[model samples]
Target chain A: MLNYFLFLVISFVMFAIGAYGLLSKRNMIRMLLSAEVMFNSALLTLLVLAATADPIRGGVVALIAIGVSATEIGVMISVGILFFKVRGEIDVYKLSKSREQKSRRLKT
Target chain B: MIDIIVFAILGTLAIAFSLLVVEHRSLVYGAISLGFLGIVNAALFALIGFTFIALFHLAVYVGAGVVFILFSVTMFREIPTVEIRVKRIALVIVTLIAISLAAIFWPYSNISVVAQSISYRELSKVFTEDYWFPFLVTTIALVTTLIEGITLARREAR
Candidate 1:
Protein backbone atom coordinates (compact mmCIF):
# COMPACT_ATOMS: atom_id res chain seq x y z
CA MET A 1 0.00 0.00 0.00
CA LEU A 2 2.71 2.42 0.93
CA ASN A 3 4.71 1.52 -2.15
CA TYR A 4 1.84 2.28 -4.47
CA PHE A 5 1.14 5.54 -2.72
CA LEU A 6 4.71 6.65 -3.11
CA PHE A 7 4.63 5.76 -6.78
CA LEU A 8 1.50 7.82 -7.24
CA VAL A 9 3.12 10.79 -5.55
CA ILE A 10 6.11 10.59 -7.83
CA SER A 11 3.91 10.33 -10.86
CA PHE A 12 1.93 13.36 -9.81
CA VAL A 13 5.08 15.39 -9.25
CA MET A 14 6.29 14.43 -12.69
CA PHE A 15 2.98 15.50 -14.16
CA ALA A 16 3.13 18.84 -12.39
CA ILE A 17 6.67 19.46 -13.54
CA GLY A 18 5.70 18.64 -17.07
CA ALA A 19 2.72 20.94 -16.85
CA TYR A 20 4.92 23.77 -15.65
CA GLY A 21 7.28 23.27 -18.55
CA LEU A 22 4.49 23.11 -21.07
CA LEU A 23 2.91 26.27 -19.75
CA SER A 24 6.05 28.32 -19.22
CA LYS A 25 8.48 27.31 -21.96
CA ARG A 26 8.67 28.98 -25.38
CA ASN A 27 10.82 26.44 -27.19
CA MET A 28 8.82 24.01 -29.26
CA ILE A 29 11.26 21.17 -28.62
CA ARG A 30 11.15 21.82 -24.90
CA MET A 31 7.38 21.80 -25.02
CA LEU A 32 7.45 18.46 -26.79
CA LEU A 33 9.79 17.15 -24.11
CA SER A 34 7.30 18.34 -21.51
CA ALA A 35 4.55 16.44 -23.28
CA GLU A 36 6.72 13.34 -23.24
CA VAL A 37 7.18 13.74 -19.50
CA MET A 38 3.44 13.96 -19.05
CA PHE A 39 3.05 10.83 -21.14
CA ASN A 40 5.53 9.05 -18.86
CA SER A 41 3.50 10.03 -15.83
CA ALA A 42 0.36 8.68 -17.44
CA LEU A 43 2.10 5.43 -18.25
CA LEU A 44 3.32 5.19 -14.67
CA THR A 45 -0.20 5.68 -13.37
CA LEU A 46 -1.52 3.03 -15.73
CA LEU A 47 1.13 0.54 -14.67
CA VAL A 48 0.60 1.16 -10.97
CA LEU A 49 -3.15 0.71 -11.33
CA ALA A 50 -2.60 -2.43 -13.30
CA ALA A 51 -0.15 -3.74 -10.74
CA THR A 52 -2.73 -3.36 -8.01
CA ALA A 53 -5.69 -4.86 -9.80
CA ASP A 54 -5.25 -6.60 -13.17
CA PRO A 55 -1.74 -7.26 -14.45
CA ILE A 56 -2.74 -8.96 -17.68
CA ARG A 57 -4.98 -6.26 -19.02
CA GLY A 58 -2.71 -3.54 -17.69
CA GLY A 59 0.32 -5.06 -19.35
CA VAL A 60 -1.45 -5.26 -22.69
CA VAL A 61 -2.65 -1.70 -22.45
CA ALA A 62 0.80 -0.50 -21.45
CA LEU A 63 2.31 -2.24 -24.46
CA ILE A 64 -0.07 -0.59 -26.87
CA ALA A 65 0.31 2.77 -25.17
CA ILE A 66 4.07 2.53 -25.48
CA GLY A 67 3.80 1.83 -29.19
CA VAL A 68 1.42 4.70 -29.71
CA SER A 69 3.67 7.09 -27.77
CA ALA A 70 6.66 6.17 -29.92
CA THR A 71 4.71 6.74 -33.10
CA GLU A 72 3.36 10.01 -31.76
CA ILE A 73 6.82 11.32 -30.95
CA GLY A 74 8.19 10.19 -34.27
CA VAL A 75 5.54 12.08 -36.17
CA MET A 76 5.90 15.12 -33.93
CA ILE A 77 9.66 15.30 -34.51
CA SER A 78 9.23 14.94 -38.24
CA VAL A 79 6.77 17.77 -38.21
CA GLY A 80 9.05 19.86 -36.04
CA ILE A 81 11.86 19.35 -38.49
CA LEU A 82 9.68 20.43 -41.37
CA PHE A 83 8.46 23.43 -39.40
CA PHE A 84 12.01 24.46 -38.61
CA LYS A 85 12.98 24.19 -42.26
CA VAL A 86 10.06 26.32 -43.37
CA ARG A 87 10.32 28.96 -40.64
CA GLY A 88 14.05 28.75 -39.80
CA GLU A 89 13.21 28.91 -36.12
CA ILE A 90 11.48 26.75 -33.49
CA ASP A 91 10.54 29.39 -30.95
CA VAL A 92 6.79 29.54 -30.40
CA TYR A 93 6.73 33.29 -29.77
CA LYS A 94 8.75 34.09 -32.88
CA LEU A 95 6.46 31.99 -35.01
CA SER A 96 3.45 33.80 -33.62
CA LYS A 97 5.09 37.20 -34.08
CA SER A 98 5.92 36.41 -37.70
CA ARG A 99 2.31 35.46 -38.36
CA GLU A 100 1.11 38.67 -36.69
CA GLN A 101 3.49 40.74 -38.75
CA LYS A 102 2.33 39.08 -41.93
CA SER A 103 -1.30 39.78 -41.02
CA ARG A 104 -0.52 43.41 -40.22
CA ARG A 105 1.29 43.84 -43.52
CA LEU A 106 -1.62 42.37 -45.44
CA LYS A 107 -4.07 44.69 -43.60
CA THR A 108 -2.07 47.79 -44.58
CA MET B 1 12.46 -2.49 2.63
CA ILE B 2 14.80 -2.71 -0.33
CA ASP B 3 12.10 -2.02 -2.86
CA ILE B 4 11.09 1.20 -1.15
CA ILE B 5 14.65 2.46 -1.07
CA VAL B 6 15.23 1.63 -4.72
CA PHE B 7 11.98 3.20 -5.73
CA ALA B 8 12.86 6.33 -3.79
CA ILE B 9 16.19 6.70 -5.59
CA LEU B 10 14.75 6.04 -9.04
CA GLY B 11 11.80 8.32 -8.39
CA THR B 12 14.02 11.17 -7.26
CA LEU B 13 16.30 10.78 -10.25
CA ALA B 14 13.33 10.69 -12.61
CA ILE B 15 11.94 13.92 -11.19
CA ALA B 16 15.31 15.66 -11.22
CA PHE B 17 16.18 14.70 -14.77
CA SER B 18 12.73 15.72 -15.93
CA LEU B 19 13.32 19.13 -14.40
CA LEU B 20 16.63 19.34 -16.18
CA VAL B 21 14.90 18.47 -19.42
CA VAL B 22 12.71 21.53 -18.99
CA GLU B 23 15.18 23.95 -17.39
CA HIS B 24 18.39 23.35 -19.28
CA ARG B 25 19.56 26.20 -21.53
CA SER B 26 21.08 24.12 -24.29
CA LEU B 27 18.65 22.06 -26.29
CA VAL B 28 21.10 19.20 -26.74
CA TYR B 29 21.63 18.99 -22.99
CA GLY B 30 17.88 18.98 -22.51
CA ALA B 31 17.50 16.14 -24.98
CA ILE B 32 20.22 14.20 -23.18
CA SER B 33 18.39 14.76 -19.92
CA LEU B 34 15.24 13.46 -21.54
CA GLY B 35 17.06 10.27 -22.48
CA PHE B 36 18.30 9.88 -18.94
CA LEU B 37 14.76 10.45 -17.74
CA GLY B 38 13.59 7.67 -20.01
CA ILE B 39 16.21 5.34 -18.58
CA VAL B 40 15.12 6.13 -15.05
CA ASN B 41 11.48 5.55 -15.98
CA ALA B 42 12.34 2.19 -17.47
CA ALA B 43 14.07 1.31 -14.22
CA LEU B 44 10.96 2.17 -12.26
CA PHE B 45 8.88 -0.04 -14.54
CA ALA B 46 11.30 -2.90 -14.05
CA LEU B 47 11.24 -2.45 -10.29
CA ILE B 48 7.48 -2.80 -10.38
CA GLY B 49 7.93 -6.22 -12.01
CA PHE B 50 7.15 -5.04 -15.51
CA THR B 51 10.37 -6.37 -17.02
CA PHE B 52 9.23 -6.54 -20.62
CA ILE B 53 7.77 -3.08 -20.50
CA ALA B 54 11.03 -1.79 -19.07
CA LEU B 55 13.03 -3.33 -21.89
CA PHE B 56 10.59 -2.04 -24.47
CA HIS B 57 10.79 1.45 -22.99
CA LEU B 58 14.56 1.36 -22.95
CA ALA B 59 14.63 0.31 -26.57
CA VAL B 60 11.87 2.44 -28.03
CA TYR B 61 12.06 5.59 -25.91
CA VAL B 62 15.68 5.86 -24.87
CA GLY B 63 17.03 4.14 -27.96
CA ALA B 64 15.00 5.44 -30.87
CA GLY B 65 12.90 8.34 -29.62
CA VAL B 66 15.61 10.39 -27.94
CA VAL B 67 18.02 9.75 -30.76
CA PHE B 68 15.53 11.09 -33.25
CA ILE B 69 14.94 14.23 -31.23
CA LEU B 70 18.63 14.79 -30.65
CA PHE B 71 19.34 14.46 -34.36
CA SER B 72 16.67 16.94 -35.31
CA VAL B 73 17.79 19.45 -32.67
CA THR B 74 21.35 19.33 -34.01
CA MET B 75 20.23 20.30 -37.48
CA PHE B 76 19.25 23.75 -36.26
CA ARG B 77 22.09 26.29 -35.91
CA GLU B 78 20.68 28.90 -33.58
CA ILE B 79 19.25 28.08 -30.13
CA PRO B 80 16.88 30.80 -28.99
CA THR B 81 16.94 31.93 -25.38
CA VAL B 82 13.51 32.83 -24.07
CA GLU B 83 12.81 34.28 -20.64
CA ILE B 84 10.75 31.87 -18.53
CA ARG B 85 8.51 33.60 -16.03
CA VAL B 86 7.43 31.10 -13.42
CA LYS B 87 3.78 31.41 -12.54
CA ARG B 88 3.24 31.05 -8.82
CA ILE B 89 -0.50 30.86 -9.24
CA ALA B 90 -0.17 28.01 -11.68
CA LEU B 91 2.09 26.17 -9.28
CA VAL B 92 -0.45 26.57 -6.48
CA ILE B 93 -3.28 25.45 -8.70
CA VAL B 94 -1.40 22.39 -9.92
CA THR B 95 -0.56 21.44 -6.36
CA LEU B 96 -4.15 21.79 -5.26
CA ILE B 97 -5.36 19.73 -8.17
CA ALA B 98 -2.78 17.03 -7.54
CA ILE B 99 -3.73 16.86 -3.89
CA SER B 100 -7.41 16.63 -4.73
CA LEU B 101 -6.76 13.87 -7.20
CA ALA B 102 -4.64 11.98 -4.65
CA ALA B 103 -7.48 12.23 -2.15
CA ILE B 104 -10.04 11.04 -4.70
CA PHE B 105 -7.95 8.04 -5.66
CA TRP B 106 -6.86 7.20 -2.11
CA PRO B 107 -9.54 4.60 -1.55
CA TYR B 108 -8.49 2.44 -4.46
CA SER B 109 -4.91 2.52 -3.22
CA ASN B 110 -5.74 0.73 0.00
CA ILE B 111 -6.98 -2.51 -1.53
CA SER B 112 -3.80 -4.34 -0.43
CA VAL B 113 -3.82 -6.57 -3.46
CA VAL B 114 -0.56 -8.14 -4.56
CA ALA B 115 -0.23 -8.34 -8.30
CA GLN B 116 -0.20 -11.88 -9.60
CA SER B 117 3.02 -13.09 -11.16
CA ILE B 118 2.30 -13.86 -14.76
CA SER B 119 4.78 -15.32 -17.22
CA TYR B 120 5.54 -13.87 -20.62
CA ARG B 121 3.79 -16.78 -22.25
CA GLU B 122 0.50 -15.91 -20.58
CA LEU B 123 0.92 -12.25 -21.52
CA SER B 124 1.53 -13.24 -25.14
CA LYS B 125 -1.49 -15.52 -25.08
CA VAL B 126 -3.76 -12.77 -23.82
CA PHE B 127 -2.33 -10.30 -26.31
CA THR B 128 -2.93 -12.60 -29.25
CA GLU B 129 -6.35 -13.93 -28.27
CA ASP B 130 -8.19 -11.08 -26.57
CA TYR B 131 -6.68 -7.80 -27.73
CA TRP B 132 -5.85 -8.49 -31.32
CA PHE B 133 -7.97 -5.72 -32.75
CA PRO B 134 -6.30 -2.96 -30.77
CA PHE B 135 -2.97 -4.47 -31.70
CA LEU B 136 -3.91 -4.36 -35.36
CA VAL B 137 -4.99 -0.76 -35.12
CA THR B 138 -1.79 0.26 -33.39
CA THR B 139 0.28 -1.50 -36.04
CA ILE B 140 -1.58 0.34 -38.77
CA ALA B 141 -1.02 3.64 -37.05
CA LEU B 142 2.64 2.84 -36.62
CA VAL B 143 3.02 2.02 -40.32
CA THR B 144 1.32 5.23 -41.33
CA THR B 145 3.58 7.22 -39.03
CA LEU B 146 6.62 5.52 -40.49
CA ILE B 147 5.65 6.44 -44.03
CA GLU B 148 4.79 9.99 -43.06
CA GLY B 149 8.06 10.41 -41.22
CA ILE B 150 9.97 9.07 -44.19
CA THR B 151 8.25 11.43 -46.56
CA LEU B 152 8.96 14.39 -44.33
CA ALA B 153 12.60 13.44 -44.02
CA ARG B 154 12.96 13.08 -47.78
CA ARG B 155 11.35 16.45 -48.37
CA GLU B 156 13.77 18.05 -45.94
CA ALA B 157 16.71 16.33 -47.64
CA ARG B 158 15.75 17.53 -51.09
Candidate 2:
Protein backbone atom coordinates (compact mmCIF):
# COMPACT_ATOMS: atom_id res chain seq x y z
CA MET A 1 0.00 0.00 0.00
CA LEU A 2 2.69 2.45 0.95
CA ASN A 3 4.77 1.57 -2.09
CA TYR A 4 1.81 2.12 -4.34
CA PHE A 5 1.21 5.50 -2.80
CA LEU A 6 4.85 6.43 -3.18
CA PHE A 7 4.84 5.45 -6.82
CA LEU A 8 1.75 7.51 -7.48
CA VAL A 9 3.28 10.53 -5.79
CA ILE A 10 6.44 10.26 -7.84
CA SER A 11 4.48 9.99 -11.04
CA PHE A 12 2.42 12.99 -10.08
CA VAL A 13 5.42 15.17 -9.35
CA MET A 14 7.09 14.17 -12.60
CA PHE A 15 3.89 14.87 -14.44
CA ALA A 16 3.75 18.29 -12.84
CA ILE A 17 7.27 19.18 -13.86
CA GLY A 18 6.61 17.95 -17.36
CA ALA A 19 3.51 20.08 -17.59
CA TYR A 20 5.49 23.11 -16.44
CA GLY A 21 8.07 22.55 -19.12
CA LEU A 22 5.50 22.08 -21.83
CA LEU A 23 3.57 25.18 -20.89
CA SER A 24 6.50 27.48 -20.20
CA LYS A 25 9.19 26.56 -22.68
CA ARG A 26 9.35 28.33 -26.02
CA ASN A 27 11.64 25.95 -27.89
CA MET A 28 10.10 23.20 -29.93
CA ILE A 29 12.62 20.58 -28.81
CA ARG A 30 12.24 21.56 -25.17
CA MET A 31 8.52 21.26 -25.43
CA LEU A 32 8.98 17.90 -27.05
CA LEU A 33 11.17 16.85 -24.15
CA SER A 34 8.42 17.83 -21.75
CA ALA A 35 5.98 15.75 -23.72
CA GLU A 36 8.34 12.82 -23.32
CA VAL A 37 8.44 13.39 -19.59
CA MET A 38 4.68 13.42 -19.46
CA PHE A 39 4.63 10.24 -21.47
CA ASN A 40 6.89 8.71 -18.85
CA SER A 41 4.59 9.73 -16.03
CA ALA A 42 1.78 8.04 -17.89
CA LEU A 43 3.90 4.95 -18.23
CA LEU A 44 4.62 4.96 -14.52
CA THR A 45 0.93 5.25 -13.77
CA LEU A 46 0.18 2.27 -15.96
CA LEU A 47 2.88 0.20 -14.35
CA VAL A 48 1.74 1.00 -10.85
CA LEU A 49 -1.85 0.27 -11.67
CA ALA A 50 -0.83 -3.01 -13.15
CA ALA A 51 1.26 -3.94 -10.16
CA THR A 52 -1.85 -3.49 -8.11
CA ALA A 53 -4.56 -5.18 -10.16
CA ASP A 54 -3.73 -6.83 -13.47
CA PRO A 55 -0.11 -7.37 -14.43
CA ILE A 56 -0.45 -8.93 -17.87
CA ARG A 57 -2.79 -6.39 -19.34
CA GLY A 58 -0.89 -3.50 -17.83
CA GLY A 59 2.41 -4.79 -19.20
CA VAL A 60 1.03 -5.04 -22.74
CA VAL A 61 -0.55 -1.61 -22.57
CA ALA A 62 2.65 -0.10 -21.21
CA LEU A 63 4.61 -1.67 -24.05
CA ILE A 64 2.36 -0.07 -26.60
CA ALA A 65 2.65 3.28 -24.86
CA ILE A 66 6.43 3.05 -24.97
CA GLY A 67 6.39 2.33 -28.69
CA VAL A 68 4.03 5.16 -29.36
CA SER A 69 6.16 7.58 -27.39
CA ALA A 70 9.27 6.51 -29.29
CA THR A 71 7.56 7.11 -32.61
CA GLU A 72 6.29 10.46 -31.41
CA ILE A 73 9.77 11.57 -30.37
CA GLY A 74 11.19 10.53 -33.72
CA VAL A 75 8.61 12.47 -35.73
CA MET A 76 8.86 15.53 -33.51
CA ILE A 77 12.64 15.64 -33.82
CA SER A 78 12.34 15.57 -37.58
CA VAL A 79 9.83 18.38 -37.41
CA GLY A 80 12.16 20.37 -35.19
CA ILE A 81 15.04 19.86 -37.59
CA LEU A 82 12.96 20.96 -40.54
CA PHE A 83 11.71 23.97 -38.64
CA PHE A 84 15.23 25.03 -37.77
CA LYS A 85 16.43 24.56 -41.32
CA VAL A 86 13.74 26.71 -42.84
CA ARG A 87 13.41 29.44 -40.20
CA GLY A 88 16.85 29.38 -38.58
CA GLU A 89 15.03 29.10 -35.26
CA ILE A 90 12.60 26.74 -33.51
CA ASP A 91 10.59 28.89 -31.16
CA VAL A 92 6.93 27.94 -30.86
CA TYR A 93 5.79 31.57 -30.75
CA LYS A 94 7.73 32.34 -33.90
CA LEU A 95 6.12 29.43 -35.67
CA SER A 96 2.72 30.71 -34.73
CA LYS A 97 3.66 34.21 -35.78
CA SER A 98 4.82 32.93 -39.13
CA ARG A 99 1.53 31.18 -39.64
CA GLU A 100 -0.34 34.32 -38.68
CA GLN A 101 1.73 36.34 -41.13
CA LYS A 102 1.02 33.90 -43.90
CA SER A 103 -2.67 34.07 -43.11
CA ARG A 104 -2.61 37.86 -43.12
CA ARG A 105 -0.78 37.86 -46.45
CA LEU A 106 -3.33 35.48 -47.87
CA LYS A 107 -6.17 37.72 -46.66
CA THR A 108 -4.58 40.76 -48.39
CA MET B 1 10.68 -2.15 3.63
CA ILE B 2 13.16 -2.47 0.81
CA ASP B 3 10.62 -1.53 -1.85
CA ILE B 4 9.68 1.67 -0.11
CA ILE B 5 13.29 2.63 0.43
CA VAL B 6 14.31 1.94 -3.14
CA PHE B 7 11.23 3.63 -4.52
CA ALA B 8 11.89 6.76 -2.48
CA ILE B 9 15.49 6.98 -3.60
CA LEU B 10 14.85 6.30 -7.29
CA GLY B 11 11.76 8.48 -7.30
CA THR B 12 13.77 11.41 -6.00
CA LEU B 13 16.40 10.80 -8.65
CA ALA B 14 13.76 10.67 -11.36
CA ILE B 15 12.14 13.89 -10.25
CA ALA B 16 15.44 15.74 -9.88
CA PHE B 17 16.72 14.69 -13.27
CA SER B 18 13.41 15.58 -14.89
CA LEU B 19 13.57 19.03 -13.29
CA LEU B 20 17.09 19.50 -14.59
CA VAL B 21 16.01 18.41 -18.04
CA VAL B 22 13.39 21.11 -18.07
CA GLU B 23 15.46 23.86 -16.38
CA HIS B 24 18.93 23.50 -17.85
CA ARG B 25 20.21 26.40 -19.99
CA SER B 26 22.04 24.40 -22.60
CA LEU B 27 19.88 22.25 -24.82
CA VAL B 28 22.59 19.61 -24.95
CA TYR B 29 22.75 19.50 -21.17
CA GLY B 30 18.98 19.22 -20.93
CA ALA B 31 18.95 16.35 -23.37
CA ILE B 32 21.69 14.59 -21.44
CA SER B 33 19.71 15.06 -18.25
CA LEU B 34 16.76 13.53 -20.01
CA GLY B 35 18.88 10.45 -20.69
CA PHE B 36 19.52 10.09 -16.97
CA LEU B 37 15.80 10.54 -16.38
CA GLY B 38 15.12 7.66 -18.74
CA ILE B 39 17.65 5.45 -17.04
CA VAL B 40 16.21 6.19 -13.61
CA ASN B 41 12.69 5.65 -14.87
CA ALA B 42 13.66 2.30 -16.29
CA ALA B 43 15.10 1.33 -12.97
CA LEU B 44 11.90 2.35 -11.26
CA PHE B 45 9.96 0.20 -13.70
CA ALA B 46 12.24 -2.71 -12.99
CA LEU B 47 11.80 -2.31 -9.25
CA ILE B 48 8.09 -2.79 -9.72
CA GLY B 49 8.50 -6.14 -11.56
CA PHE B 50 8.43 -5.05 -15.22
CA THR B 51 11.85 -6.11 -16.41
CA PHE B 52 11.02 -6.12 -20.11
CA ILE B 53 9.43 -2.70 -19.91
CA ALA B 54 12.48 -1.39 -18.11
CA LEU B 55 14.82 -2.80 -20.73
CA PHE B 56 12.66 -1.46 -23.54
CA HIS B 57 12.59 1.97 -21.96
CA LEU B 58 16.35 2.03 -21.54
CA ALA B 59 16.81 0.91 -25.15
CA VAL B 60 14.24 3.14 -26.85
CA TYR B 61 14.24 6.19 -24.59
CA VAL B 62 17.73 6.42 -23.19
CA GLY B 63 19.39 5.03 -26.30
CA ALA B 64 17.31 6.47 -29.12
CA GLY B 65 15.30 9.35 -27.67
CA VAL B 66 18.22 11.02 -25.94
CA VAL B 67 20.50 10.60 -28.94
CA PHE B 68 17.90 12.05 -31.27
CA ILE B 69 17.35 15.04 -28.99
CA LEU B 70 21.08 15.69 -28.67
CA PHE B 71 21.58 15.41 -32.42
CA SER B 72 18.73 17.80 -33.14
CA VAL B 73 20.06 20.33 -30.62
CA THR B 74 23.57 20.22 -32.04
CA MET B 75 22.28 21.50 -35.38
CA PHE B 76 21.79 24.92 -33.87
CA ARG B 77 24.65 27.47 -33.97
CA GLU B 78 23.79 28.72 -30.49
CA ILE B 79 21.90 27.10 -27.67
CA PRO B 80 18.38 28.42 -27.35
CA THR B 81 17.59 30.30 -24.15
CA VAL B 82 14.06 29.77 -22.89
CA GLU B 83 12.45 32.66 -21.05
CA ILE B 84 9.46 31.58 -19.05
CA ARG B 85 7.68 34.24 -16.97
CA VAL B 86 4.00 33.80 -16.19
CA LYS B 87 4.02 30.04 -16.55
CA ARG B 88 5.78 29.47 -13.26
CA ILE B 89 2.65 30.50 -11.43
CA ALA B 90 0.66 28.35 -13.79
CA LEU B 91 2.97 25.49 -12.88
CA VAL B 92 2.10 25.78 -9.18
CA ILE B 93 -1.61 25.90 -9.92
CA VAL B 94 -1.27 22.90 -12.18
CA THR B 95 0.60 21.00 -9.51
CA LEU B 96 -2.14 21.60 -7.00
CA ILE B 97 -4.76 20.48 -9.47
CA ALA B 98 -2.88 17.27 -10.22
CA ILE B 99 -2.43 16.46 -6.53
CA SER B 100 -6.10 17.00 -5.80
CA LEU B 101 -7.03 14.80 -8.74
CA ALA B 102 -4.71 12.06 -7.54
CA ALA B 103 -6.23 12.24 -4.11
CA ILE B 104 -9.67 11.87 -5.59
CA PHE B 105 -8.63 8.79 -7.54
CA TRP B 106 -6.49 7.39 -4.81
CA PRO B 107 -6.71 3.60 -4.61
CA TYR B 108 -5.91 3.42 -0.92
CA SER B 109 -5.15 0.04 0.64
CA ASN B 110 -6.52 -1.64 -2.43
CA ILE B 111 -3.28 -3.03 -3.84
CA SER B 112 -1.36 -6.08 -2.70
CA VAL B 113 1.71 -7.70 -4.16
CA VAL B 114 0.38 -10.55 -6.26
CA ALA B 115 3.85 -11.47 -7.31
CA GLN B 116 7.24 -10.05 -6.56
CA SER B 117 8.25 -10.39 -10.21
CA ILE B 118 6.74 -11.57 -13.47
CA SER B 119 8.59 -13.89 -15.78
CA TYR B 120 8.98 -13.35 -19.53
CA ARG B 121 7.04 -16.46 -20.36
CA GLU B 122 3.92 -15.04 -18.70
CA LEU B 123 4.33 -11.79 -20.60
CA SER B 124 4.72 -13.69 -23.87
CA LYS B 125 1.52 -15.55 -23.24
CA VAL B 126 -0.35 -12.31 -22.72
CA PHE B 127 1.17 -10.78 -25.85
CA THR B 128 0.23 -13.73 -28.01
CA GLU B 129 -3.19 -14.47 -26.65
CA ASP B 130 -5.02 -11.30 -25.65
CA TYR B 131 -3.14 -8.18 -26.73
CA TRP B 132 -2.07 -9.02 -30.23
CA PHE B 133 -3.80 -6.02 -31.77
CA PRO B 134 -1.71 -3.51 -29.85
CA PHE B 135 1.43 -5.44 -30.70
CA LEU B 136 0.56 -5.31 -34.37
CA VAL B 137 -0.24 -1.64 -34.20
CA THR B 138 3.04 -0.87 -32.50
CA THR B 139 4.94 -2.85 -35.11
CA ILE B 140 3.28 -0.95 -37.92
CA ALA B 141 3.93 2.34 -36.19
CA LEU B 142 7.62 1.65 -35.72
CA VAL B 143 8.11 0.57 -39.34
CA THR B 144 6.26 3.59 -40.68
CA THR B 145 8.25 5.91 -38.44
CA LEU B 146 11.54 4.44 -39.66
CA ILE B 147 10.63 5.03 -43.32
CA GLU B 148 9.19 8.48 -42.65
CA GLY B 149 12.19 9.63 -40.62
CA ILE B 150 14.63 8.46 -43.26
CA THR B 151 12.69 10.10 -46.06
CA LEU B 152 12.46 13.36 -44.13
CA ALA B 153 16.18 13.46 -43.53
CA ARG B 154 16.91 12.47 -47.12
CA ARG B 155 14.62 15.14 -48.47
CA GLU B 156 16.42 17.78 -46.48
CA ALA B 157 19.78 16.53 -47.75
CA ARG B 158 18.64 16.81 -51.36
Predicted candidate 1 versus true structure: per-residue lDDT over A1-108, tens digit per residue: 245777888988898888888888777888899898889998988988898888888989999998888888888887778878898777888888899999999999
Cα distance off (Å), candidate 2, residue A81: 0.4
Angstrom error of the Cα, residue B64, model 1: value is: 1.1
| DockQ, each predicted model | 0.59, 0.62
lDDT of 2 by residue, B1-42 (tens): 777687778989999998998888888888898889999999
Candidate that would win on lDDT: 1
Native contacts present in each candidate (fraction): 0.55, 0.58
Give the per-residue Cα lDDT of candidate 1 at B82: 62
lDDT of 1 at B80: 69
Candidate 2 lDDT over residue span A23-52, tens digit each: 888988888888788888889888888988
TM-score of the second chain for every model: 0.85, 0.83
Highest TM-score: which candidate?
Answer: 2
User: How well does candidate 2 score on lDDT at residue B128?
Assistant: 85
lDDT of 2 at B60: 79
Model 1 lDDT at residue B2: 71
Over 4 Å off, model 2: B79-84, B107-115
